[model samples]
Target: MTTPQQPYQAPSAEAFLMGGGGAPTAKFPAFGTTVSGRVTERPTVEQQRDIKTGDKKFWSDGNPMMQLVVTVQTDQRDTSIEDDDGRRRLFVKGQIQKVIADAVRAVGAPGLEVGGILSVTYTHDGTPSGPGMSPPKQYTAQYTAAATAMLHASDPAAASPQYAAAPPQQYAPPAPAQQQYAPAPQQYAAPPAPAPAPVAQQHNPAVAALQAQQQAQAAAAPPPF
Candidate 1:
């Protein structure tokens, strides 16, 4: 009968990133929730493999993806934090998991081209060999200056002012060559006046006379007899 092997109690990537023992760790922030923590170290490939294989179990899956234990001295009210639930700090396990998944997707699997997974390792001991890079202690001044310039350029307000202040130089389109055609003379036409109404000919003069006589007689009569 084979005895069950004792579970490994190796230091967690988080613990290592937080600095072995006694050192404080940074906080990372999560979307929607008010949790902030610094990712002291990202999980390495070997570490991930071990965790999946049950060789390691540093954190519980159901817990927040972006979870980090409170530092010995974490400020819950810091402006960097999203919410102030009164805890030393907020841990967003879900957001962290998404970020990890996205990273894996981007990096893709080993031996496949494109998208590289990020890992952090303080010390190398009995860990499986894989493509990995350690965290940088400090960045170069040139890189910092370049990054700052890029951020400044990315600002809408800053970019707007630069564009507004220096409008693009206008380049007037060349005038089309004028044709040599002669000018046409202007001609005006006067409108004709309306014709007067025509008077009836004397063919009905007798009838007109009779009608005039009747009118005169009627005018001469005062009231009905």
Candidate 2:
């Protein structure tokens, strides 16, 4: 018996940062420009086309030319693009695509995903090979893995604005107030003196009379001597 395959479930639209509406497309108009943001959607491949002619473009080898589309939530703003909702849809093609792909691979990520960070910078214009051909735009890219980005985001201490503005001040709990506990001097207590023993009294009358008679005989014998 063959095991049944699980049904495919589509990701939520919010994952693409499309909860409100479609994100505005980003454009790079100058060299040395950069755009960085958290990726809100996985990169997708799409057919490349000419914006003016609305026709499909092909590579020199006659293969269908394609582009990578990535959606991100960024704070960077571009005057050329009207939408300033901070969400941008990046269309990566030609040299830029390779740069981004290489960056992702270098970090050992299979591909870009939501929660990952992507930064792309247009470094300079490349020299054109043929006459009258426009120079290609060169780009540099950087990527942070989703897990690493999430760790920074989820940590309260790391995500604090104060922490980013400056290195977190080392928190040394004030050395617990030293308590100088001096033992109080014990009072000197002398043990109470024992009570005096009681003296015994003579109670026998006969014994008392014999003692008196002996005393009388001794007195008389002394006088005769």
Give the worst 10-residue stretch by lDDT in candidate 2: 192-201
Q: Give per-residue lDDT, candidate 2, residue 4.
A: 33
Prediction 1 global C-alpha lDDT: 0.37
Query: Where in model 1 is the C-alpha error above 4 Å?
Result: 1-9, 12-31, 34-40, 44-99, 106-167, 171-225
Residues 1-225, candidate 2, lDDT per residue (tens digit)?
Answer: 232333354544664454543578776789887889999866666667788997767767567677877988889766765657688888888788899999999999888988999999989999997999999989999999999999988987778866544558887777778889999877755433434333332456666666667666655553221
lDDT against the true structure, each candidate:
0.37, 0.77
Off by over 4 Å in 2: 1-21, 60-62, 77-83, 163-225
Name every residue pair that clashes in candidate 2.
none
Per-residue CA lDDT of model 1 for 1-225, tens digit only, reads: 233343464665655665534333333332222232222233322222142664422346332122333222223455554443223321213334344344435434322111121221122123334558433221110011223334665888665674544568999999999999977765543333334323563347776676667667766665532
Query: Candidate 2 at residue 30, lDDT?
Result: 97
TM-score for candidate 2, residues paired by index: 0.60
Q: Candidate 2: how many backbone clashes?
A: 0
